[model samples]
Target: MKKNQSKISIKDIAQELGLSITTISFIINKKAKNRISDEVIQKVEAYIEKVGYKPNSAAQSLRTGKTKTIVFMVEDISDPFFSSVAKEMEKLAFDSGYKIIFCSTDNKKSRAIELISMFKDRQVDAYIITPPEDFQDEIEQLVSENQIVMLFDRFYRDADYNYVVLNNYGSTKRAVEYLKNQGFKNIAYVGLKTELSTLTDRFDGYKEAVREANRENLSLLISFDDVKSEVGNKQFEEFLELHPEIDAILFATNNLAITGLKILKKKNIQIPEDIGVITFDDRDLFELHAPAITVMSQPITSLAKEVISGTLKLLKRKHSIQDKIQIVLDGELIVRKSS
Candidate 1:
């Protein structure tokens, strides 16, 4: 250690390594691989490491306009599915020298709009959002401004936005078809009523499959907030009572299935005997139930990886719709005894 160089700067490092300030800056910021020789790059890196020189990130970001931060907005951070995906993304982002700021949108338009404004104020490098309804304009504006935006979990079908999402329609259709193949009839889809494309697609899949089999497309839908309320529980019970012929049920989400399971358990309804059950999204409770539940298991890690990669890719491009990336992944239908 040089006693006099206690407060070393980029200028000091540049002078000591006999490299120009621009050269040192390029190397430090990982932007010199093509222009700088490997030997020189290694030497500069070694010197920087030995001197423990850390660039002033605030100043660097001012010059480069990069925060190396990604804001990930989900429907609900407390939900198992969103949290699990976030855990995977956090590590991947850190490894790539970026950090994630997680925010829960709760499927609210105003909240999402507020978050987007915050992202601008904070100079967030990129946005990976699971958006709610009625905010397509905000997204479009961001895209027009040459900002990095990656939509995940759900996206607008009509909009040419960068996104990675599950094949909700296909997966749900397959699950219902599987149940029908196993001799379960009069299957009813229990789903949340929503305009969100993903949820709508899931219901559409269930409807199409049921109709194809020369059966009535029976379904029960409730508000998203009603899933946990007393009103929601009553709707499930009454819906079952109204249609005793419904021998099998496809719950659109884990939360809905959990509520339905409780009602069934209270009534001593034996699964697969009185009624078969299947749901989207696997949970630990589903795996450990009295009769383990059947599920359409989403690729959480794959979703995370794709979003991170897509966000980074978007950052490099013009950040317009023309260069947008789209990914559609499949969910595994894990059959268990409950179905």
Candidate 2:
């Protein structure tokens, strides 16, 4: 019979090196510290290297009770902000010997719950979530089970968990203030109507800015379900027609900004001439536009590093982290002609 050229197992290495399977496992897992002699360790290590033996991750996971996998759940994997951060995080996690599984929740509670359950079944070592609305209960359950979880972008107020997020309120407030200072009155805020803290914080910032400036607050909060549809575009068009005096608009997200820009283009409203625009998240599309869009750019790399480090600390049990760790990074205001 033709031999199967499957991966070389720990057992094969152990037998060839005249050592016990336990010895090989201990060394491979880096658990033999001071327990095994250097001579035997060196001998086994050399032989394993010579034979090109790679440990079976499935078996190792079963023995160690760690899958070395991280589940990254975001509102939308295709969103530039999430995708950029995920890419950086994936590289960092891979360097630390962990794999990341990316999933999009589409801001749907049911989809988030389903993804969480699926990852749990596969025994992921940790979860990094940009949670949807009303996900506190599910997250609290994960935390109760000692499952490592790191919330990103948005978080539930009632849930205590590790998170790395931007200063949403401050960033939006600053962007609005910049517009107000530039003589843009009748500024309108465009955002999704969602209970997620991230959007709410941004909305609060816009309201606060308008109030502080002694200007009337104008906003269009589209339904989360309809934000991407023709209904949303029509809503924007109606909003503009309802308030022809709106000189500037701040969109709470990149996608919202994109939609608003498209509406403006259709209406032949020139940017910064008839309407000034500023968006919460930065994107290449914004930069490539005729008049580049000013944006509140999140520190994606910093966020990714903090998240990866926090997750690794939890997985390695390196230190006793607080019950809940909250790391809020600042967003940079990238000035452009649009604003």
Clashes of each: 0, 0
What is the per-residue lDDT of model 1 for residues 51-123, given as tens digits with 9 covering 90 to 100?
Answer: 7777887988998989899999989999999999999999988998899999998889999998899889999
Off by over 4 Å in 1: 1-6, 14-20, 31-44, 319-323
Provide TM-scores for the models. 0.92, 0.95
272-316: candidate 2 lDDT, tens digit per residue: 999999998888989999999999999999999999998887777
State which candidate has the highest TM-score.
2
Q: Candidate 2: lDDT of 295?
A: 91
Q: Give the per-residue Cα lDDT of candidate 2 at 63.
A: 91
* lDDT, candidates in the order shown: 0.90, 0.89
* C-alpha RMSD for every candidate: 2.4, 2.3
Q: How accurate locally is residue 286 in candidate 2, as Cα lDDT from 0 to 100?
A: 91
